[model samples]
Target: MHTCAPPVETLEELLEAHPSINGNFGHLLLLQKDADDGTLSQALRPYFESAHLDARQAFHADIGIDLHPDAGDGDGPAVTYPGCLPLTTRKGLFGEVLAGLVTEGYPLVGEHEWCVPIFLFRYHEDARNYLFSLARRPERRRQTVGRLGSDFIGLLLDENGAVIRFIAGEAKWRKTLNQSAVDTVMLGDLIDDPAGGGARVRSGKGVWNDLNNDPPVPIGVRQLQRLLQEYDPDGYDAAILSLERALVVREPVPLPRTDLVIVAGNASATRDTLTCFLPFEGTPPEYTAGHDLQLVEVVLKKGEALIDAIYDSLWSENADA
Candidate 1:
């Protein structure tokens, strides 16, 4: 299977959202855990399991880990799970997966049935190279790193089963959604003070900046096309061709694109709860990317606690059996 099922009911029950704010350039959403709902222990594990499904499978395969049903006889390879990854790596993976889940579950940019058929976790060479290192050259240190390129990608297929549009996403997770933290992501990180007179300067490169400069037909789309062709050629033949037509160097077909940005974290203590990181009344000035944009803010309480609990529970039933 390309992607595991999202826990739609679980998400609906566990989280609450403010009414979506619409603008000509994009729409903004703010979501947070619902305090009144008391069954987070039950509702959340399934939600996180769905989020990390691709990473668990992809990472295990990439690192040569194997799985067998109830094989505790010590006759097979160790079944490594992504749940055991370092805190940073685990947090990043959650952001990416949650972004895709929201993109697919909700009607964003007037599309439905958004499919994230492949996750690029296998291509996170930092983890693979470090984890797969052998005795010849012992691994220097483990790298808690994220995959390069777009963090999330989803395709919308037409009645003919050809891809009509795509959404490329930048998903980030922060400890707090304060202005400085938000600026460091949407705007560039603060550059070092050049002169003796210290001044916080931005590096002029950030998520919005990168998205503005992205090619109309993103490289992620090409990567997706190749994966589908290689893995399920007959099943995704039309999608592959449609992507190929759009990717051609000359006179390529123009495909509609949506930019998705998800910033998920705990609400900052210093900030009032009435507003969010992105502007609500109008399109964000930071987002110059002409494509339709869907901005999502996911704020949570005791986020790390929830993250740990949910991740630890993935496949626990199988492991315990």
Candidate 2:
């Protein structure tokens, strides 16, 4: 039986309510309230042993993380620091705060909760290496989409034309990734044979590996194009645009079998529209610089720009369509 959780407004409140999440760790959430424009600066505070609030404040100011959004969301007012005090009238501080938490080794738990980031100290370089190793491959039509419910991992190709490997991970710094979470990401890509010997149909006769009788089939972008033309002809342009955006962003091309897209930090989404469509799997939290964080950010920003441009160009082309 699953136990229902309560809805808490503040980060601190959530930590207090669910201690077992993300390894039973507690966190210190910090925010600076600016009296002038009412903007706020927010980050997680390091634990303090002393009872004095001033001591905690002094320590936190000395060492704290800054929240950075993935890409600029158009023009807006400036957000301040310390109390996350208002320097601009833009209400974007919350998004930045969540982004900061993701960078500081925290994962958004669900639609509302985030994993607690306590005792998760990083020496920076190690964390950077991890981030860089999580590098994503550019999306291509030459690759294969797993199935209806496979875990969405980005593919990386070697110098050769063949795919070498891919990247997929779960950030449970706050909560443990159970079997369900694991299955959610990997269930769709079910190949009948892990070894290249035979083809096992989902509910039919299993066949022996007969390369002479049945030549090894190569799946490529032409197949993908055909699939789009047949099933999602209306979204053919969008699909092509999305594929190009993924390539420009250096992200993996998502499977077309389902309505999910893998965005930053291995997060996934099911939105149908273009802009609102998330580019990865998992919750939509801002990811921080690990190792290749900067590179990933550059690719993501470029991809977003490319997608927007494509939509504009297509909109004009389809003025009559």
Candidate 3:
């Protein structure tokens, strides 16, 4: 699997999509700006603590550690928070669900290790590209090591819930996932495949290195075509499949849901585009357009049973909305 972050600017947009967040939570770890801080926990502590209530909280939350680049030219810390769950176990009500999304057929786009939002479409930074490579730049380090800037950092899992990828995506979101977006996702997947995303993240042309020298095919154009052929026979389905494939591989699970649906992107594509091509859990999609966004609802037959245990735990603990 792979990993990436949501754009910084769109955090509000995402929060708005959720009923839980009547407005932004000051307790949430919103990026204060880019810096080369090495302590991801420091940046996230406030949010975690705000969400934490008692001892059993540990059962719901887990912490992870790793490293990334410095703010500018050096190295920094690579830390992770299972924000609410550990990456190693699948014992809780949501545990199997997290594992299944990571291990199975769908893409896990916009999900972080601790289940924080890591979708690339939530941020507004430009995708980093250099003359020789195509990868995002790591952050610069600050004198005092603490927290990461974006929520995209985390662990990724394969279909069996095995960690396959880990990364810190740039804080750039896209409104239109046109050719550039497709190319970006495809290239990221290729470079981060056999070799992890760490080596090439700061290097330009990591994936595009051979583009100028190799057989004149655009770096990921061919692979994109092949992926589309297999997962998407029709054009619209191809688009949804592309997005789904990228997200699932990166984060290794379906994105965290706000009221049971992934409401993150501002893509102009229709609900039918997603249902027709990249359907999940066997639910047919139904759409409702609001002034701010489009709402696509899918009815799951076993929905109540599947989430009953999870919700029951929440009720038992007196969890908040």
Candidate 4:
């Protein structure tokens, strides 16, 4: 689930934006699938097939999956062709990949030549552990959990190989973009009174809360540094050194940060195409950003079935005949 190299061409052809609304704070864009999903799904399939490339064996190789001498002896895939990832996991993954494509394809606030050098798919230990369950003789107990830090990260590097800007995002998918679901995620969940009669109040916990309180330097940057050092040391040598300088104890180099939030889901039958989960006016007061902010709302028709279809077809063409 790493690098699908940006510019997923079909995205441009498939999703049509409802007149972009520009404001003093940032831009708001609502993209909906062009009608005729049968054609749309076929067009979008290849990109996702590439996006969900089975990374189990490749990422785990460095983590000791290769120690078993029998590994790679057969020409067939060693891991699950398509392990049945939980519905939530699949939706979350789709959101991240969709956000990554948007991050790479769409223009940002200030400076925006973004590239996701490597996807941190290896960090998906839940997926990794799940694969292990099916691969071994006796199935291993599944580790049911979610990742801790950033949902997805992308960056822009300068000529000198120093990181100049970073894109950090939180992408979510819901079957319905109803008010309660939207409010609970973006703002915070309302708490009920113990006596069952008091007014409900926000819990002070949600996407906005997490974004506002993120550490100056994101946890993903450090994680990216480690992956770069391991996977492509020579290719990203200077990049690593630059990160080391920034990660140092005192007088660290400051990296400009950009935050993105994408909420994509099935559109309400009665909802207008222009309707969006995020505000269309000036930047929401919730964003305390010292850097840039981007928002995307992708509304689809029958998206769950499309997602399942696309994920099921990943790597299918390459099956051993």
Best by lDDT: 1
lDDT of 3 by residue, 1-321 (tens): 112232323323222221111121101111112221323223222222332222122222222111223232433222211222221111221222222222221223333243222222111111111100111122431121111222223334444443333332222222333334433422333243346545533223311222222221121222323433443356334333433444553453432221112211233333233221112232222212111111121112222232333332332322221
Once fitted onto the true fold, the runs of candidate 1 whose alpha carbons sit more than 4 angstroms away are 21-24, 34-58, 70-79, 134-141, 192-199, 319-321
**Candidate 1, 1-321: lDDT as tens digits:** 344666666667666656463643445455565542336644655555655555566666666665555644745433355654667877887787677778766666554578888765655666655555531244344546688888878898988879998989999889888878888888888987666477878876888898989989888788778768877999889999999999999999999888888888888777676567765555677777777787777888877766676666677775431
Most accurate candidate by TM-score: 1
Q: Write the per-residue lDDT of candidate 2 for residues 1-321, one digit (tens) a residue.
A: 001121223333322211111221112222211111211111122211111122223222333322223324533212211121121201122122223333222322211222111111111222222222322222211211111111112223333322232222111110112323323332322357655678642321111111112211112233333333444556345544443443343455542210111222111233122222111232222321111111011012222222223222321221111
lDDT of 3 at 36: 18
TM-score of each: 0.85, 0.18, 0.19, 0.84
Measured on C-alpha atoms, candidate 4 has an lDDT of: 0.69
Candidates in order have lDDT scores of: 0.71, 0.23, 0.26, 0.69
- Candidate 1: the clashing residue pairs are none
**Mind sharing the TM-score for model 4?**
0.84
Better of 3 and 4 by lDDT: 4
lDDT of 4 by residue, 1-321 (tens): 255555456666777765343532345455656544566556656555555553544544533445243556655454542335666677877887777777777665664688676655557777766666656643453435656788778878888776787888888888987667778888888897555678787776888888999987787888888878877898888888877877776998887788888888888777776766687665788777555777777787778877777666665555421
Candidate with better TM-score, 2 vs 4: 4
